[model samples]
Target chain A: MTEERDPHLARLFAEAPEPQADEAFVDAVRMGMARGRRMDLAGALAMSAAVGLTCVALAGPVAQAVGQVAGQVAPVMAELFDVPGGEILAVAFAGLMAVSAMVLSRVRV
Target chain B: MRPADSLRLSNAPEAQVIALAAAGSDEAFAELVRRRQGSLRALMRRLCGDAALADDLAQQAFLQAWRTLRQLRSPGAFGGWLRQVAVHVWLRHARLVRPPLDPIEDLDAEPAAESPDPAARLDLSAALAQLKPTQRLCIILNYVEGLSHAEVAASTGWPLGAVKSHIARGTARLRRLLSVEVLS
Candidate 1:
């Protein structure tokens, strides 16, 4: 603030003793940064594992939904693209792989 | 950083050093810390009025700055950005360890403790330690660090009115403690 300053206080602050840079302080910060990084990594891994477990727990329902959707869409696909029944399984597998890739991409691990 | 690496980036411009540090060069970050430690530590010392705690908090601030360095959009803004980081760290630490600060109305409940020693009389740290945490942070950020009231407001997440109030009252209290004659 323009009005916040006082000359006397400024002078005292100017006169305040400043600490010298210590290599030890630098080392301490370096160690702390490394530790912080490890903690971040561990947190990310934990979150990934939690997400993985959730996906595993939901896998049966998810697979069943996908299969049901594929079954309904397969007739339209065969009529539209002249695809056969067995090839519809390939399309379903490909769709499942694409969805799994998407889910895994968001896991951050 | 190697002892030889100390002088390597010492002479580089701050913006360039900041850019390199943002690029994840630890050496550059080291240089940035070395160049900045003096003022940052001094700011912490004035804010907390304790050398050891100030350094500890300053180091924590630097570690935080390092972790978030890549998010800095403007390397030229590092000084202000770093100060904001330091203030946040201080706020977090204060909130965790210290009792909630006395409300502004109650800030003057206790007169600054009397000290018989003349040295303590002359010591600004002793006087600063008498301020409530909010007042102390605002006073230091405004006076010592030369931040504007609005800047201090943004830094501490306090309203502009509150920052102005704290600085005014804190400065008045400091003048009274130091026996510095008020202009009024």
Candidate 2:
């Protein structure tokens, strides 16, 4: 159904005196915003610290797992392709894993 | 910009103020709040039926608006955007702490005694309180906030048909309760 304008109701609202926001109210809101900003900063710092600690705690196990996977895979690759320096490939793969971990840690999402 | 310069921005047009605000000017945002807080608070008061709660909701709305000011694509539409934010804040709060049903009867039992003529304001407030939340919101947004039915639908994210129906039913109820006949 189409809506029709109700001027009487509109007039009642328009004519109703508005409640004023005193200086105290405005100051309170200003303070509230300042507090909110500080909280946001604190939250961001806390998140960053948490992510850093998590990465630090997991770094050892992650590195170990990456090294084991590379140790098992690099020789297979070397044998399949007749490539030398399986040890070098293993170290390179571990380094790549560390860099990826750091990158992911820095990402907010 | 210096602190004093930012205060001067309050005299600037809304679009200019919004632009400055988006650029991280707290004073510009404060100016916007100073200008718009009255109507926002009034709308909240009418919706929530508690002055203190309305003010709290208004502050929350302004804070939310400041955080997401950059998302506002049209600087000219700040008022409408702010109103939308206020409504969302109220809706969220309502969802968390749902009001008991039959608020109208409660208000009717003990009308506002402060007003010399309680019948006038009390009747309207009581009648409004009786409306279902969605119907009350639609009526307030359309009549009180001066939004068209389509604008009310867009703001509330309700279907256009639902908005129309709510307004129609709400208005009929209000008219009957107020004991006033439509002039035209």
Candidate 3:
């Protein structure tokens, strides 16, 4: 169904006074943006610091765990599949996972 | 663009201003804000029914735009993008503080007594305050801001049919409230 147009309402809306943003409002917004930018910078720096510290803190434990797991699995894999360099492969896989975790943590989404 | 170039961008086209603003030029962003604030503020006031809140929301919207300016795919659509931000800000605020029942129903029960000179006392803001939120949004965006129905739908993320229905019903209600006579 076609809707009827109202000339009176349209005229009133057209003639309605537009609200102005005074100097104070503009300055306030500008200042707010500045503060927001500062906060954003501070937040990103804090996050980066936190992530770096976390990786540093976890490095020893992660290395130990990866060593133990690799030690346990390498012989089994070598015996089962006759694979060479199983221990090196496990260490490389663990390093890849740790690097992936660090990268993923920094990603915003 | 350098700091000195901002003064030049003030008079430049919106696309240029948006591009510079996205490139981290505060002055360019300020220019865009100065250019669009009036209409955005007006739209917010009509939508929110409070000047102070409208200004607050508009400012927040501008800040948000500044942060995400690079995400703006089309520089030419800056005005619409800014408006959509303002509307979303208002909607978020509205959602947080909205009452259980529709506020318009409460307003409807307490209609002001007709003025001795009805036409003289009629106000666009007052009439708008009487409308349901979605209806008022559609009405202001369509009639006041001069957006097409599809544009309104795209901006509000509402369906095109819903936008049309709201405009139709909202206009009819407004005419009745203002005692506008139908001219066949």
Candidate 4:
């Protein structure tokens, strides 16, 4: 069936002009792809903030429990870790987890 | 020239490039674009009827191919697979943006060159413009691009019967156009 068609048409169309693309267009696509790869810092920061706030919210009861524990060993903790204080330590741990979660969220895979 | 030697489907450099691109290798993806850009652009232009639109579609197609390369089972089928991506990308883009009506009938019909020399093949591009998008693609994939019917079916995602029908119809239209040009 195909043989019945003009063999020359295939040849002619086959001879089509080489498809040329503008260099800048190619560059733009490359740039778009590059931008797609980079992390959106603002988005990441916002997510981090949300995670941190959530952690802090969830840490309320945990913090009360820690406070109860600390009341019993306040003097001991003071001697062992006399820095930012236990409440601060607890908050810091929660903050760290939130930050980790936020960073993890930014990853594509 | 001769459709750039009818590139074989291979897991070679082409497939590796697609794989690497899928793995987020920008350079590898760029290499794939650079290698296939000519043919892809040509096909897009033939199918879409505009060089600028073709370029845009080609870029999108390459990006899409890069994003989904991992889904492809055989790396050896990258070229055909990529063409399929291009076709979908073109169609999608066309859908999103209305196609400007082309008075295809108004275009002057030109005769196919008698010469088989490399320069003669240059006329193929003009002849392609006379065809409908589907017919042009069929001819390009089958003759200029040298993909088998099975490959064409696979690449276009059309049933084997549909592929055969399109090829037959497309070839007839092209032949008629060629004859018209010759007589004119």
Candidate 5:
């Protein structure tokens, strides 16, 4: 047990290689976690949509009001979405905004 | 890095970073990865005895840490937690890849480190090679990283007395094997 303090062995242990993880690997793990969160949010949104559709089928007047609002907004939204890739860009922007909101809520400010 | 921007909580205390990481904070996880990578690499090198394998194992360990972070019992105990994860990663890989045994005979015949380059640290590595996989891991964790016998036991899931015995026996064998080169 006393010989356990042998400097040679200790030095060897100290000298053993210690490599650092690169930024790329760290980025990959972060991306994986973010992707998982995005998928979860997507699933929740889809489930919500399905439930909303079921409710709309059961409630005629409420569904009619929803349709009226969509009818009014659809033309403008359609124009905004008409450009090539515009719909995708808009969806991405909305997702980014939601993520930003979540992040901001967690902040001290 | 700004407080808002730095994201990596590595600069914070291990407990703080661990808690943040456990709660699903990417910055905290990144910080944990950055802070522990060096120690993990050193431990893996001793256990696997190959630089490349050590690198791969260290990478895999970080990935596992991400998946298992929430299961960690105490945020304050993250260092030991990471070490434990690394041991598991090494053992898991050991199942698939049979690491080369230590060349004890070659080591015994080699002279002391009079070489100019520190690359001769391979002598220490070769001595570690002589140890059985578990024994080598215990030695590295106990002697090299300076973990307590209980910490080693807890991390490796070995009994307390068994941990002591492994350390004592492994240290004695390594000392005898490297006595010539290490001592002279």
Candidate 6:
């Protein structure tokens, strides 16, 4: 049904006071939006820092584990890829890939 | 903001304002807020019955609109789109709390709990607060704003049947309310 279904409602609404277009309300919303953006940035920074600390704490063991894994796989990768610089080049490539993955994940965040 | 940008924002048509806002112009978005605030705020007040709460929800709606502005495909549809946003915000806030009391049958006979403004003390705002949230939603969109039932349904994302039902029930309930000046 349309509003004309009830003329009383239309008349009542028409007689009600109009809400004012207060500049204060606009400013409040703008401030709220800016504050929200700042909060998001602060939250992202805090999360990044927490992740960085965790990575630092685990760096020693993680490096050793990667080193052992590289010893096992580097030669095989080099042979498979048919590279002249065998094991060292394969290990370096793997390390570069891992660093790239980390950077991408951070960027996505 | 640059003086030229501010000038352009104020002088621009609504569709231009929406486009500029979508493209990340703060001044244009502020202009949108300024232009649209009156009606949106009024609708919120009718839905909520408390001036402060209505303003808060209205502000939240604008903030939400800004955040998702890029998703608004049609700039010309911003008024309806913003009403949808405002309705969503009000509904969310309303859902968080049950109505404290069944609105007094004679809603206009007494003062509104939070709204002390004499203009707001009038019958309509108090009567609206008494209606259930969905009922109130349908009434404001359909009756006050003069939307057809299908338009109210579209704006509220309610089924057309449900919108009609709420309007029917709300109107009857308000008619039953004592001391509402319209019926009294």
Model 6 C-alpha lDDT per residue in residues B1-184, reported as the tens digit of each score: 8899788778888998888889988778899999999999999888888889889898999999999999998987888888889888886787578543222222333333333343443366777777777788888888777789889888867677777777877786665552345443
Of the two candidates 1 and 6, the one with more favorable lDDT, higher being better, is 1
For each candidate, report what fraction of the true interface contacts it reproduces.
0.69, 0.49, 0.63, 0.51, 0.53, 0.71
- Model 2 chain A is weakest, by summed lDDT over 10 consecutive residues, at A100-109
The lDDT of model 4 is 0.63
Model 2 has an lDDT value of 0.77
lDDT of 1 at B133: 85
Quality class of the docking in candidate 2, CAPRI style: acceptable
Write one digit per residue (lDDT tens) for candidate 2, span B1-184.
6877866785688889899889997778888888888899889988988889989999999999999999999997888999999988987887678765332332234322233332553356777876767778989998888788899989988777777877887787677666553222
lDDT value, candidate 1, whole model:
0.80
Which 10-residue window in model 3 chain B sums to the lowest lDDT? B100-109
For residues A21-92, could you state the per-residue lDDT of candidate 4 as single tens digits? 456656766876766555456678889999999877766655555455446554654554556566677566
Question: What TM-score goes with each of the models?
Answer: 0.74, 0.74, 0.74, 0.59, 0.60, 0.74
Model 1 segments more than 4 A misplaced:
A1-4, A47-109, B1-7, B102-122, B180-184
Instruction: Name model 3 segments beyond 4 Å from true.
Output: A62-109, B1-6, B99-121, B181-184
CAPRI rating of model 6: acceptable
Give the interface-residue alpha carbon RMSD of model 5: 2.8
lDDT of 2 at A58: 78
> On a 0 to 1 TM-score scale, where does candidate 2 land against the true structure?
0.74
Listed in order, the DockQ scores are 0.43, 0.41, 0.40, 0.28, 0.27, 0.47
Whole-model lDDT, model 3:
0.76
Ten consecutive residues with minimal summed lDDT in candidate 1 chain B? B101-110
Q: How many clashing pairs per prediction, in order?
A: 2, 0, 0, 6, 0, 0
lDDT of 1 at B139: 88
Clashing pairs for predicted structure model 2, backbone only: none
> How close is each model in CA RMSD to the real structure?
6.1, 7.0, 6.8, 11.7, 16.5, 7.5
